[model samples]
Target chain A: MRPFEYASPNSKEQVAALLGTSWEQGAILAGGTDLLALMKDDVVTPRRLVNVKGIDTLRGTSYQPGNGLRIGALTTIAELADSKDLAQYPMLFEAVTEAASPQIRNLATIGGNMCQRPRCWYFRSGMGLMPMTKDGKSLVVAGDNRYAAILGTQTGAYFVSPSTIAPALIAYGAKVRIYSAKASGSGVRELPLGRFFITPKSAKEREHDLKPDEMVIELIVPPPPQNLKTGYFEVRQKAAFDWPLAMAAVALQMDGNTVKSARVVMGHVAPVPWVSDEAAATLVGKTITPDTAMAAANAAVTKAKPLSMNKYKITLAKAAVKRAVLKAGGAA
Target chain B: MADDRPRKPEDNSGVTRRDFMKVSAVGVAVPVVLGSVMDAAAEEVPIQGPGKVPITLQVNGKKLSAQLEPRVTLLDALRDNFDLTGAKRVCDRGACGACTVLMDGKPVYACAILAIDAQGRMITTIEALAEGDSLSPVMQAFVAHDAQQCGFCTPGFIVTTTNFLQKQPAPTAEEIRHGLSGNFCRCGTYDGIRAVALAHAGGKQS
Candidate 1:
């Protein structure tokens, strides 16, 4: 780790100022679970580290009935997993718990997890193994792409977004509050989780629409629908601290025994949280029987473009989606 | 009671002409010396530069303050500067809980936390588990059960078990497993560890 100046700012304004100063010089230090690893791996070398934990306003979990839950940016994953409010939002709790081991969760912040970099081995290893083009060639077209990506291939970067909470939040209809340095007042933009992600082809920018200097101050999850049932399911090799191979977050608005509306999102298969409105639309006005659930899951994966080694991910993703939908629908 | 005696400057040996010639030769090799000094300085640079960041931390029953960098991990600050080595460092990554410490009464991986982030929290480490020369009841139970083999992971287990006991002194076997799962024992002392935890939880100890 290179020597860097340290600052423990007391307010979000100070934090934004530090970040707005220069991207090349400063990096925000939240939980340090991911940032420290990146620093150790030499992936990012910032000249100054601005610690945000000292800010009193960036730390708690609040809930209001008929309104929503507002989680501070510095709230730890362990806190979220053990939150009482999360009992009303089981999908959020389950996603937070399934993210990493207890030790990792103890120190990983929710904001940091949402804004973490991709878990591409090539990116971490700094080997330039990602499909880069001298003129226009997909280098990862033939290499080890077992965990690359099954969607968003045209833009050439095939890395999975390793955030478990993002999919669940998206499924629950959460919005982010971003704070910028230059702005007189912080800007609050509310977008459904489905619209939060943009592929490289769709928008050649980064995963989330957060600017370089803006910080995610808090996440607000609107009150769930009266008849909505939500659940999250992830498939992994072992209980080891690796990202999920395939995951699904399902939220269904059921009318009696029939589904009225549904939100089914697949994770780790695309560059961002892949929301399947097509699959969701197929479930409305239909009974959530095994056949209906299977059809929805199959419909979700029809447009999936699997890489060579990651073809297994398509089956795994379908199974996850099916299980999550069944579980959320209370059929399992 | 003072026996005041002035020391004489004459007792010191004066510089020799040969030493002066040696110093002159070293001056001629100044570029190489300066280059090596600069290289050493670069390598010795601290990860977080020096500054007295005001942090109010309540550890155990006392409040303490220490100058630390934003990048200095809680594990490093505690072990290196504060001399509290009860928390071990096995896999510096959060994989192993050898550096588990409680913040605001909840267990957290010390190695994964930045010292600056832990400000204004009540931190409890393994060092606080003893009273005078006597070990805490949980520690005594661990010793009686022979739970520790090499003792590398003992501090983390002790701290984690202490926190768990604080929450639920009488935990079920499943709860014990879940609570201690954050820690790793390279020596496979899990059976004994479980026995110690159960014994303590069963009112055999505190």
Candidate 2:
């Protein structure tokens, strides 16, 4: 990695101030898991690194009765996986544990995970976010795109979202709390976690909604319904430390044997965590059975327009959805 | 606003416009002074460098000072500067656990951690696992079960396993396998490693 100026800020505002308003000037150094790799690969070379680890306030996970679960951005993946408070939301627990190796989980934070760059080889090989040829021909559309996005390909962005916990968080109705120097008053802003992800229209923009000057300080998950049941399932080639091929998270509000409401989110098969309203609609007011869950799973992937090499992802995604829905409904 | 809520420390000591623009000296469309803390005193933190900067690390019960750039990883610092080469550097990324070290009693990849960022944490490397003349229990098990072949990944495995046993002294067979998933052995010494881990777990061995 190239030499860079380091700033250890004690507060979120200082970090934002140091990071200016553009990606060229500085980058936030949260866990150093993804950022270090990007720097080493010369994918992103910021002149200054704003280390936010010194901000003591943004560190752990806690839950309040009325306010719900408030997880500090600096909480490590291992910390989240082992948090007793997360036991109530088993979908989140399952998703986190299925992430990278234990060693990585010890250092990788939830905030960094939220903003991690796409893991597309094209992107990693210094090809801009949207890889193009000399004459401006798209590389990922015809090239090796087995892991490219199946759902949001209508947008130019093709790389799959690398976050394992995003689907689960989105399913649980989580909100991301961002601290920006430009924000009015207290400089804090909260948006639904699903809205945090975006498909960049150009190479200069990021895949997430966060500005260069903003930092994700915390994640707030509202209290679940009284009869809430959630399940998360990921299909990977190996059981070891590897990214999932396809995954799904299912959250159901059950009225005894019937479903009152549902949220189904898919991961690793889209540019963003794909929330399927059709799948949710199929589950509402219907009793969850093997056939009904499979139908919902089928509806979840109905709109997946896979690239040449990724048609297999549609099958895996359907399996993931069926398994997650069944597990949430207590049918499996 | 909650009337009883404590006021932020930065509220009393206001951040000047000069400081904000001075720190962020780029194409900043909007410049605004901002600073706050939950409880820590509002003290100005000096920015360290692109060049070498002095930093002290708490490693293996010792305070070791070194002049290192911000980009220097903890693995490089431990091996090159401190001469603690027990933590190998295979697959410099966090994927392979060759450079595993215990940071604040948690096993973390030293290769993925910046030396400057590892300041206050208590880092325990493979060298610190043994007590003088005697090897640690996990090391003894590795020897007894012949759990190594090329021995390249042994230090990291030993460090990780020792920490794992500390947390779960009697882990099940599946737990042991899951615990050691971070480290990879190309020589396929997994059977021996599993045997050693099982033997170490004593009566609970499956």
Candidate 3:
């Protein structure tokens, strides 16, 4: 790695000032599990590394009586996975546990995982940042796109955001706290997890809505409903140390036997966590039987347009949703 | 490929003369002079590096402090700088658990963690498990059951098993398999490893 200056800031203000001054050439160093790998490969050549690990304010899991859980950005995956407050929010715990191997989870931070780069082979392996043609055409169309996007492929980039926790958080209606340096009165802003992602054409922006100099401080998960059932399931090629091929996060509120409300989101299937209101609509006021689950699974993928090699992912995604729904409904 | 035939001893004189000259030049006093110089250099160097970043790292029951690079991994900082070599570096990636160490009382792959991020946390390597020449109960059980082969992956397995047993001391066979799934042994010593964990859990060995 090229030599760069390092700063261990003690306060969020210090970090914000450092990042604000050096937006283009500076990188916030969280766990360094993902950022260091990107730097070592020269994918990102930041001239300054601001270490945020020293900030005591950005650590630990907190729970209030009515407001639910608020996890600091620096909290490790292992801590979130084993938290007692997550017993009622089983889908969140399940997603964190199924993310990576034990070692990666120990070093991977919740904020870092949500803000990680795409795992697209073409974008990661080559010299150029984005895979392009000689005439500057996107190369992902004809490349090895087995795990690429299935819904947002009409736009140029087909890479899926490799975050297992984002879908679960979105399903639970979580909110993110962003802190910026330039602003004085309103330095912080909160956005729902569903509105956090902007597509390439929509915003002409990055995968996430975070500003270059803004830092994600905390994530707030609303309290789980009283009669709620939740489950997370992922399909992987191997048992350990690999990303999921496709996954689903299912949350259901049941009134005795009939479904009161439901939220279904699919991971590794789009540029962001793909939420299907159609699937949720199919489950409302209906009993969670195998037939209803199959119908909801089919409705979830109705708008899905699979690429040539990823047609099998449709089936894998369907099975994942079905299994997640069944598990959440206590039928499996 | 061209020089298949053996050369005569006269042709080998060049090599012998060089070897003889090398041996004579470094005879008896050379080692003594070099050792003193090395000792002086070692004395001049500080025990910890610069910046002396304040970090409270509790390994076993002792609190330790060291100045290190921000990019230093927990595995390298422990093994190379602190001389805690029990956690071996096999793959260096997070794929293998040979470098497993307990951080905040949970078994984690040390290679994947940055040293700076491990501040204000408790770290436990395999070196702190036993007291002096005596072995811990888990280590004794491992020896009694012959649970290691080649012994490269023993420290990681032992540390993981120790943490697992602390949590679920009387784990069933299925739980044993599930808990040990994070680690891999190339020599296929898993059967013996499981036997030792089971034996220790059953109070069969001290």
Interface RMSD of each: 15.6, 8.8, 17.0
Candidate 1 local Cα displacement, residue A220, angstroms: 1.8
The lDDT per prediction is 0.75, 0.85, 0.74
Give Cα distance to truth, residue A155, candidate 1, Å.
Answer: 2.0
Give the best candidate by TM-score: 2
- lDDT of model 2 at position B130: 92
Candidate with the greatest DockQ versus the true structure: 2
Q: Which candidate number maximizes lDDT?
A: 2
Per-residue lDDT tens digits for candidate 2, residues A1-332, read 87776778886766766776678678999998999989989999887789998888999999876777889999999999989888678889888887888898889999999999989999998887888878776798879988888898776788989998999999999999998865788889899999999988877777899887889999999988789999888999978688899999999999988999999999998889999999999999999899999999899989989888999999999999999999998878
Q: Which pairs, if any, clash in model 1?
A: none
Tens-place lDDT per residue, model 1, B60-102, is 7787677655556788888887788988877776778899988
Model 1: per-residue Cα lDDT over A98-187, one tens digit each: 777667777788889888878888777754324454755565666788998887666776888789889999988898777764455444
Task: lDDT for model 3, please.
Answer: 0.74
DockQ (Cα-based) per candidate?
A: 0.15, 0.36, 0.09
RMSD of each: 12.7, 6.6, 14.6
TM-score, each model? 0.81, 0.92, 0.80
